[model samples]
Target: MKVSMQISFNLDIINKCVCHKCPVQNQSECVRTQMAGLKTSFREIPLNPHKIPKAYCLNGKSVCKGIDRSKPCICGSCEIYAKHQLSEAEPGGFYCIEGKSA
Candidate 1:
C-alpha cells in the first residue's frame, strides 16, 4: 500500500511568527520553539502560506528568486517545515524572506 501524507499552508501561523530574535543557532530549533507557543490545531492546507519580506521578496518579478542560497538554508532543519510538510524549494529561505522560522 502507498503511504499518504497531509500537507498544510497556514497563513495564520505565518502572520503570528516571532523567530526574529531567537538565538537557537539553527532554523529547526527556532521553529520548534515558535510552535511550542501556539494554541491552534495546525491543520494542513495546499498552498504555500509563508510570506516573504518585501525587501527580500523582490527578485525583479518573483518573491524569492533573488535570495542568496549559498548562505545555507536552515529551513531544512526547521521544525515548522517538518510539522507542516513544507519544502525549502517551495518557500526557499525563511530568514531573509519570511521573517525567520515562525
Candidate 2:
C-alpha cells in the first residue's frame, strides 16, 4: 500500500530554518534573495512562484545550480525535520538537491 501525506508551510518553520547555514547554500543568489524577501514580510509571499525560499521539504527541489553537495546538511537539526519526522521518508533530507521528502 502507498500512503500520501501533505507537508505544511508556515513562517515559524521558515524562521527557524537552518538552510541559511547549510554548506550547500554558500554564496547562493537564491538564498540571498530569499533572505532579503523574508525580512520584508513575515508571511510567505509568492510574488514569484519561482522565488519562494526555504521549506525545500515542502516546496519541492531547488532550481539553484550553485549549491555544493560537498557541504554537510543541517536538516536533521531543523525544527521542521523533527516535527515532520522526515528521516522516515524515502529520499530523505538533502531537500535542496533531492527535492521534497517522499
Per-candidate TM-score against the hidden true structure: 0.29, 0.76
Tens-digit lDDT track of model 2 for 1-102: 222337556666667778878878766877777667765645445434245557787777777767778888889999878776788885677888887777
- Scanning candidate 1 in windows of ten residues, the lowest lDDT window is 53-62
TM-score for candidate 2, residues paired by index: 0.76
- Candidate 2, superposed: residue stretches over 4 Å from native: 1-5, 41-49
Per-residue accuracy of model 1 over 1-102 as CA lDDT, tens digit each: 222223233454444333333332224443344345433323433422233221111121113233443455444554554554444334444445444222
Best by TM-score: 2
The number of residue pairs in model 2 that clash at the backbone is 0
lDDT of 2 at 91: 63
